[model samples]
Target: MAATEATKAADDAYDVIVLGAGPTGENLADRAHAAGLSAVIVESELVGGECSYWACIPSKALLRPVTARSEARRVPGLSDAADVALDSSAVLAHRDAFAAYWKDDGQVRWLDSVGIDLVRGQARLAGPRRVVVDGGRVLSARHAVAVCTGSRAVLPNIPGLAQARPWTSRDATSAKKVPGRLVVVGGGVVGVEMATAWRALGASVTLLVRGDGLLPRMEPFAGHLVAESLAEAGVFLRTGVEVREVRREAPGGPVTVVLDSPPGPGGPGGTPSDEIIADELLIATGRAPRTEDLGLETVGLTPGSWLDVDDSCRVKGVTGGWLYGVGDVNHRALLTHQGKYQARIAGAAIAARARGVPILESDRWGAHTATADTLAVPQVVFSDPEAASVGLTAAAAERTGHRIRVVDQDLAAVAGASLYADGYRGRARMVVDLDREVLLGATFVGPGVGELLHSATVAVAGEVPIERLWHAVPAFPTISEVWLRLLEAYRG
Candidate 1:
């Protein structure tokens, strides 16, 4: 639709006004529509958000081939596959197809089919329930205004860095041709996964981290194992180093990086010189909420900051309780799935409030509250050796003063693991609450472990007793048999 036509259409009032059309906003609108409420989602960018085009979908498409080859190489019968390199062009093409060639027509059609309105422009709060888009279009909400703008990558301030045309997470996942020499900065999921993907595509990838470990958020052993696999896959793994300056003399040429630490054996990045040159540089340091410029000040909230919300995702301290902060903007759980979950709770709560229905805020498992965001958030890092974790780590549980006992299991010892691959290597750790005999947390580090995460998520979220879990028998031979080993280890 043209800008004028869109503005004219949005002039009318809606029951739910969603700012940002990511998965969170989309789900929120869907839920509102299901409750017979009119919804309009305003977006400044593509309708499907970052997960559709960049972070989750495209990154996984690029990574799936790398993992498939790695999985093939581990099987003894596929010796020829072990020597074969990935077809980088085909991999890139697959990523493009998954990302829908960066188009939002399908998403727009879906919204239309569901009777949800989409406004294409920047949206900001005018006051209570009023929103103003970029082209001076005014929109009013009767019940709620949900901010689901999600987040953006943070780039650290370094000399000549911004001018150097560095790649952020978006560029890393969507690059046309892989750079011959790629340097990834940050130890988080983005850094490691992209490092794994580009290196497998034949780039001489160098991963730099100021911290000592690759995955600082996960268990220590998870980092150790992934770092080992990355190094073995020919990624120059450098830890305890910082980039002081970046120099790119000519445009689209090699970029030189100078580290703060003194050069060691073969220099800082395993090169002869103290400086590391790369065709492209990626900064995956962190993410910041997109609420910075959404005109929060008009609604008595600080601009450029996280939106604080309650269990039901309603913005706290807002006078009318018509404001909601869903997804990354609220900083509850930054994962996409978690954000969508918040949207559901917030949507139902908003609808109930609109109907003057009582909200069961105190009930932890009520329909209008998002309790799992606090306790059982699950995460999966799609590296060569995948790492999946739900709930707390042992250290986190201990720090939180939970009476916990840690049970460890070797996944290779499971009969299914041997059948899956030759000499499969993996580990599983479950934090058991001694007082309740329920799982507090679970972490799995190995190949093909992502599939096992939801079971752990359910166990932690439901707080199912260990004895009850034991009754949930496993099939004869599968990686899932590791659950039996973990139980036996805990019992012994």
Candidate 2:
């Protein structure tokens, strides 16, 4: 809507207003509407946000086929349907289809169907309980206002990187053709994923990590296994390294990166040069919360440009309980699922308060919520053998003063794992809080383990006792049977 119309609409009081129409924002609106409260979601960009358009949905859609084909080749007995191939054109077509070609029509229809008002424009905090739309018109909320602004990929401040040109996760994931040689910076999930994806698509891939291993935040074994997996996939793992500088070199100009260390057997390992060149450079360092230009200072709500929220997702400095924040915008766990969880908790809490229900301060289901984020935040890497993990790491558990018992299992021993391939070498590790008799965290690294994560997620989130989890049966010949083996190993 235009600024005038937006202002006119904003002139009235809304019971709850959610800014950003990503999964978290949408979930917030849905839960609010379900509780019989009036809610509107304001979206400046695509309704489905980064996950739907670029980050998760499209990338996974592209990688799944390549993974399936690779699996079929590795496990010949399971597949009898002759030759398998991924049609590059069809893969791109499917990726576009998954994103609806960036169209918001389906999202709009869903919102209309669910009775949530849809506002299209930039939104910023206009007051303690109000938002300014498109930089002009203002909308005030009666109960709560939420910020679910998500995050943007961050490019590092490396010299000549911008002039030499580099692709962020956004650009690389949406490319039409794979480059001949792709150099990816940062050994986090995105870099590892793109490295494997493009390598499978005929690109020679080199992955650089500032740390000594891939996924440094995960357990050492998990990181080691993943780095090994990537290396086996023909990716050059340049860990514990730095890209000192970048410059365009040659006629067509490949970006030449000056490394901190030379490559040679005696001089430092691979090629004996202080520099390397590649057709494309991809920076997958990480992301920062999108909290700028939101007028956070208007209500004394600024905490170093990020809104400080309590357990209930309420903006800490906003008086009278008016302002709130959720999703990646809160600088909490940046996973999309975690964001949605916070939104639901916040929406429920706000809805109950509007009804004068005398809500509890930290009810498990309240708006000042996000209980799951603390214990059940899960992540899955979409690379060939896919890595999935939830909750705390072993070090994190120990740091928290928990008595921990760790059961780390190799995938090949599990009956279900052997069927995955003849030469399957994967890993699964669980950190159990012995004091609570519950799992504090879990990590699984292997093919087809993506779906297996939710079970562990529920176990950890629900605090399901390891003894009780034994009854959560798995069907025959399924990778899930690894759970039984895991429990057995834990028991032993």
Candidate 3:
């Protein structure tokens, strides 16, 4: 433990101290500074965080070269000239360029330009409104403290797996060399993407899905289509199988896995197990918040492996009311964009409290405010025949006590979607709140659907009426024209 002049001298001085300079934390600091509050950002890792270094940037970079070449090949006229093969060396180099090789000088310069103090070290809650950096330097806050540390992949309790060692999303995304044979132990978005990416790059890929289908959280039809797409891309999908054991074969040889099918409804549990062999084993199971070693208990807040926050993104327990949690750490919709939205709100609230202004929950330009989260949070999977979703599902809306109406359209039936790809087969589902005639949620699964998510997000977030949405026309001969077909179907 370490003491500072502020600990012995000043009681309260800092307006806001944002922890973890990820997209969310950076947004929080930016909003705090914009609110004219003294703010400092503490980050132990890369300033741009996982999204820049490993998750989004590098993964997307790995896909870009192939995606571009594939599109060119799809067009017969350009197919003759399109011989663009992925140069693994060049792709890795470009990804490194995008992430600045994990350097923070560019981000640091930007933060300094915005008048936000940048501190380097791990940070934890010392008290209600205080942060202890490196377990010593105490920075007392007058207003609020935001935690945006984000989440990491959860390791499963498979026997001998930990000892065997495995690759997570980080390792898979930033992989320098593509394995000759890759076995993915999850059928989630990340797993599917990695499988397809490496498969296209000439790696034999196998996917083991504990669930019955791909993207279990999405529409059942979407799962079917995505699974079909994966199969077409040469991904071997094994469903309803449990990984019994994982063991290293030789010093540098392929890893071997023992898998067993669960007891089915019609059978006794006496089935023999199967074996899978791969050069690399990647675990893309899921993610949990990084709440450990953060002194959550000291703040009177009960964090259950993940920090739980309210709709307004405030930590539950605290005596003097100084604790705030945002982003993946808060465990509310772990998307980076949603986290940033909450961070902006938390930052504004902190600045307002410091200035003696009433902290409002949803304002256009207040410190403590959120619009993009509770209303509509969008997510896009950057895989071939991309998947995108926003807002509440039909079931979720009904659970929330809203009578919902669903409108679904197939890509083959929509004019723009027909031209999107020569043989593009995809689906779009829309959940509407019948009482309000507003969109509860929208999901699109097809080629180039990621870009189409923002329009749905705006409609859901802005609460744009279905009638007004009709006036917002999509361009001709574009995939987005499906929006018109959706609106018409909804009206019908």
The estimated TM-scores of all candidates read 0.96, 0.92, 0.91
Clashing pairs in 3: 345-369, 348-367, 348-368, 349-367, 349-368
lDDT, candidate 3, 14-79, per-residue tens: 688888888999998898889788777778788888788878887888777766766676666787
- Flag the better candidate by lDDT, 2 or 3: 2
lDDT of candidates 1 onward, in order: 0.91, 0.81, 0.78
TM-score of 2: 0.92
Tens-digit lDDT track of model 2 for 1-492: 322123354345778888888898999889988999888888888887888888888888889877887778777775665245457778778888998898878888788877787778888887678888877667778898888888888878888877876889888778887688989998888888888888877788988888778887777776787788778879888876778899985544688887875455312456444677899999999787777777787887553355668777887756798777898877778888888888888887788788887767756634456777777789998887888999899999999899999898887787877877767778888999998799999999888878889988988888899889888898878788888888899989
Candidate 2 ranges beyond 4 A from true positions: 1-12, 77-85, 249-253, 262-273, 362-368
RMSD of 1: 2.1
Order candidates by TM-score, high to low: 1, 2, 3
TM-score: model 3 vs. ground truth = 0.91
RMSD of each: 2.1, 2.9, 3.8
